[model samples]
Target: MNKEYTVTDDEVGTRLDVFLSNQPDNPSRSSIQKMITDGAVSVNGQTKRANYKLRLSDNIVMTYQPLQEIEVQPENIPLDILYEDKDIIVINKARGMMVHPATGVYTGTLVNALLYHCHGELSGINGKIRPGIVHRLDKDTSGVMVVAKNDFAHNSLAEQIGSKTAIKEYVALVHGNITEEKGIINANIGRHPVDRKKMAVVTSGGKSATTVFHVLERFKNCTYVKCRLLTGRTHQIRVHMAYIGHPLIGDPKYCNSKNKFNIEGQALHSLNLTLNHPRTNQQMTFTAPIPQDMQNLLNYFRQTI
Candidate 1:
C-alpha cells in the first residue's frame, strides 16, 4: 500500500525527511533518509534529496513499507509489576531475563511475559517481538524498566529518554575501592576495534559518554558505588568502570577478575529512574530493590571477611 501527503502552507521549509518523520507510525529519521536516497519517496512525481526543503501544496508519495511484523507467542511467565496504567507499565525485571527475543532465541524473554501479562495489548511501534519495550536492561542487569501500552506513550517515553529528560541511576560492586568519593568519567565509546562483541573507550570515532560515580561503601577489596549516566551508551557503566581499572565484580564481559563472589553475572543493578508521565506530564520516580544475590554479596563482604 502507498501513502500520500500534501504539504500544507504551515509545513513549508521543513526538510523532506523531517516531514515524513513527523507522520504517524513512520520509521526513524535515519531510515527515512535511506528511503529517500533509495527512491522510495518522491515529491511531485520526482525523487528528491532527504534535505530538500518542502514546498506548499507539494504532493508527496511514499512507497516504502515498514519492517515486517512478526507476532511472538505469549508465555505464562510472571512479571514483577511495579506500576501499571492504561498508558504504561513499569517492571522490576529480574536478573537473567532477556528483554526481548533475538536471533536464534525466542522464548523466556520479557516480551513473551509482557505479551501474556499485558494481554497482548502492548504498543506496536517496536514491533510485536519487543512490543511496549521503551528501554532495556542487560540480561544480567536487574532493575526498574518502563513499557508503553500504545504508540503515543511509546513516542513520549522515547523522546524523554533521548532528550535526557529521563534520568537513570545504577548501583554496582566493583573490584577495587575507588579512592575518590565522587568522580566523572568522560570519554568516547565505540565498538571494540578487535573483539567487535565488546565496547571500549576510544579516542576517535566513538560517541561521547559520561558517567558520574560516587563511592557508597568500601569493602576489603571491592567497592560499592552509585553510577548516574549522563549519556547512555551501550555498557557505559561497565566500560567506564573497567577503563578506570575497577571493572565490576562478576561481570563476565567486562571484568577479567576471579569470581570471588557467588553472584550471577554482574553485580550491577538499575536502582532508580525518573521520568514524566506521558498523559499527565507529572514527574515520577521508580525504584527497584537490589537483587538478593547482589545484597548477599555485600553482606558477606561486611561480615567476617
Candidate 2:
C-alpha cells in the first residue's frame, strides 16, 4: 500500500527520514533507505538520496505495508543531553546503549529514550514507527549524537552531514606507539574480503576515505590519538588505524592477541560534534567528556606496564 503526504513548513529543511517520523506510523531510517533503494519512496515524484533535504509543500509518496508487529516501545532509559532546542537534540550517548532498535537489541537503545523524552516530537523519515535518527555511532562507542525533533531540522541536519560540513572528532586508545604527531590516513574502506561482518582497508572496490589523526599522548605501548573524520565510512577510524599497525585497544575483532588492557570493547569515544542549526543558521558545537571506561583505560596505561 502507498500513501502521499504534503510537507508542511515544519517538514521543510528536514531530511526525508526525519520528516517521516512525524507521521502516524514511523518506519525506521534503515527501512526507509531500503524503500528508497527499491524505488518505493519518492519526493515530488523524483527519487532522491536518503539524505535529501525536503522543502515546504514538497509532496512525499511512500509505498509500503505496515508490519504486523511494531516493537518500538518507550523505555525509560537514561539520556545525557548536552544540548536541546526546538529543532534538534544532541545526546552524549553512553556505552552499552544501542543506537536504535535492531536484532538482539530491542530495549534500552537511544531510540527508546528519545521516544520517551521527545514523546511525539520525533520526525518520521522512515515511517511513523521509528523516529529522529539521522546518523549513527557504534554500540560500544560512547559519544555525542544528534537527533532531529522535527522534519525541517532533520532535513537541514541531513544536508549538513551529507555535504561533510558536520565536524566530528573522536578520541581513541590504539595499540602501538605512533611516532608521528599528526598524519592523515587516505585509504579505501570496504567490507572484509573473507569476513562479511567486518570492515577493512582495501585498495580497490571501495569508497575513498580520509582520516586525520593527531597523537595526543603516548603510553608505554598504547597511544592516545585524536581523530578527525573527513569521510564518514563504516568503521573508518578503526580500519584506518589498524591499517597503520595501530588497531584500537580492546577491539576483539581486529586487535592482535597481545593487548595491554582488558577492556570490554574498542576504546573509541566521540568527544566533539559541530554542525549548523537547522533553522537558526548558527553554528553549534557539542562536546562530550570521555567515558569512564575509556578514561580508566588511559589511567591503566599511565600507571602500569
lDDT of 2 by residue, 1-305 (tens): 67898887756788876666445444556766777878888988998887889888888899875442456888788899999988899999998778877532466888889999988689788554458888889877899999999888889888888898999999999987999999999999988875546788887898999999999999888899999999989988989999999999888668875655556778999999999899988998999999887888888878876
Off by over 4 Å in 2: 1-69, 128-130, 258-262
TM of each candidate vs. truth: 0.77, 0.75
Worst 10 residues of 1 by lDDT: 63-72
TM-score of 2: 0.75
Best by lDDT: 1
Single out the weakest 10-residue window by summed lDDT for candidate 2: 20-29
Candidate 1 overall lDDT versus native: 0.89
Candidate 2: residue 27 lDDT (0-100): 57
